[model samples]
Target: MLVAAAVCPCPPLLVPDVAAGAAPELDTARAACTDALGVLAASLPDRLLVVGPAGQSGRGPHPEGTRGSFRGFGVDLDVRLGTGNAGPAATERELPPSLAVASWLLERTGWCQAPVEGLGVGEPLAAERCIAVGREIGGRPERVALLVMGDAGACRTLKAPGYLDERAAGFDADIARALGSADVAALKALDAELAYELKVSGRAPWQVLAGAAENADLAGTLLYEDAPYGVGYVVAAWS
Candidate 1:
């Protein structure tokens, strides 16, 4: 069952090399992510599962040694899911961008408490399916810890990626509350249609988290919340 969880945004800019000089802008978010991961380590889970949005439906079982790269984002940097073997032949598939960001975070924090793996939830997946996947994850006999990575709406401001949607703020606010309070029902109830319109990519993975924590009695803390580039980025922890 899930013993702990950390919620983070999956922007490639989180990587200093990808962001270049703009890296300092996300320093606080980076720190919060590190702290959240530390909480997961404290939980001493039997394993860690990094969940994130993917281009396709249910795209992973990304093994501990799976590889990811940021070359497409203008950097040649590469990351592995855990301290497993490193090389081109380590795994058959490359992680989706969101999972790549997750891998980067784990590498940045030097995670060592448990072996790491990954699962990619499709952006448009139904809430019911997302929850079901989460339940299956929690059903594993050993204790599991999760690192959920995905961004909230991208239409918060005129300069946002989705370009100024009046409803963006409210949507992000609700998500922030649900995450901050560990409100499972709220997460599971998030409207997928509306989320798609708002450009929020975290709904499926967040619902998955809710399913895993259903009866886990986790206490949540909102570590960070912001629309730095008009995209809602949040960092939260539950333990």
Candidate 2:
């Protein structure tokens, strides 16, 4: 069953190496993510599942030691899902970028309390399907903790990735509230069509979280919220 969860943004810039000279811009958000992960560790879950957006449907079950790299982002850094075990061989597929960011976060925090795993939910997955996958994850007999990573709208400002959009602020505001209050219904009701138009990649994974927390009585805390590069990035914790 779900015992705890941490919501984070999956921007490659979260990695200092990837961000390079601009790394300082995200220091606060990075710190908040660290604190959020600490909360998950405090819950003492039997397992930790890192959920994030991926390129295609049914993209992962990235087991422990699965590898990820940031070479494409102009950094030659590599990360593994967990500390021990020899991961996938050269012939095996590597994790998607979202999962790679997740792996980086785990490594930054030195995660060691539970066995870590990764699940990549397709960006365009329907709410029903995402929720179903989440329910299955929550149904596990052992306590499960989640680290969900994805970005909100990237059209908040004129300089944003998606450029200025009048509706971006409202959409991000609603998401912040739902996550801060642990409102499952609000998350389930998120409009996928609108999200797609706004470039909100977090929709599917957040809905998955809504499903997992459906039966749990969780209290939430909004740790961070910002549009540093005009892309909405939020960090929250539920326990």
Candidate 3:
């Protein structure tokens, strides 16, 4: 059953090496992520599953020890899913960008309280399917915790990745409220078309979270919320 969860944005920029001089801008977000991981550790879950958005090449399950790197982003840093054992085959499948970011966070926090694994959900995955996947995760026999990584809208400003959109602010506000309160219905009800247009990669993953927490009865706290690069990045913890 679901025991705890931490939601975070998955931008590679969260890594100091990737952000370089601009890394200070995300210090608070990084701190919040650290605090959220502490909550997950306190839950004492038997396992930790990191879920994130991915494209075709990166989709599917990634066992513990699956490798990820920031080389593509001009950094030499690499991370593994967990310190647990994973056969050589595990390293053959690379993690998606979002999961790589999660791996970075786990390494940064020195997470060793639980065995870890990863799943990469597609951005275009239907909400129903996403929920189904989440239900399967939440229904696992072992106590499970999740580190969900994905970004909200990317069109907050004219210079944003998706460029400015009139509806971006309202969309991000609703997402913030839902995540802050752990409102499953709201998350499940998110409009996919609108989200797609707004370049919201978190929609599918957040819905999956909604499905997972359906019976967990968790209370939530919004740890951070911002659009530093005009991309909506939010951090929330549920326990």
lDDT of 3 by residue, 1-239 (tens): 99999999999999999999999999999999999999999999999999999999888899998999999999999888999777886878889999999999999999999999999999999999999999998889999999999899999999999999999999999999999999999999999999999999999999999999988999999999999999999999999
Give the alpha-carbon lDDT of every model: 0.91, 0.91, 0.94
| Regions more than 4 Å wrong, model 3 | none
Candidate 3, clashing residue pairs? none
- Model 1 CA lDDT for position 55: 86
lDDT of 2 by residue, 33-81 (tens): 9999999999999999999999963286788887889998989999988
Superposition TM-score, candidate 3 onto the true structure:
0.98
Q: Per-residue lDDT of 186-235 in model 1, one digit per residue for the tens?
A: 99999999999999999999999988988788999999999999999999
Model 1 CA lDDT for position 225: 97
TM-score of each: 0.97, 0.97, 0.98
Residue pairs that clash (backbone atoms under 3 angstroms), model 2 = none
Best by lDDT: 3
> By TM-score, who's the top model here?
3
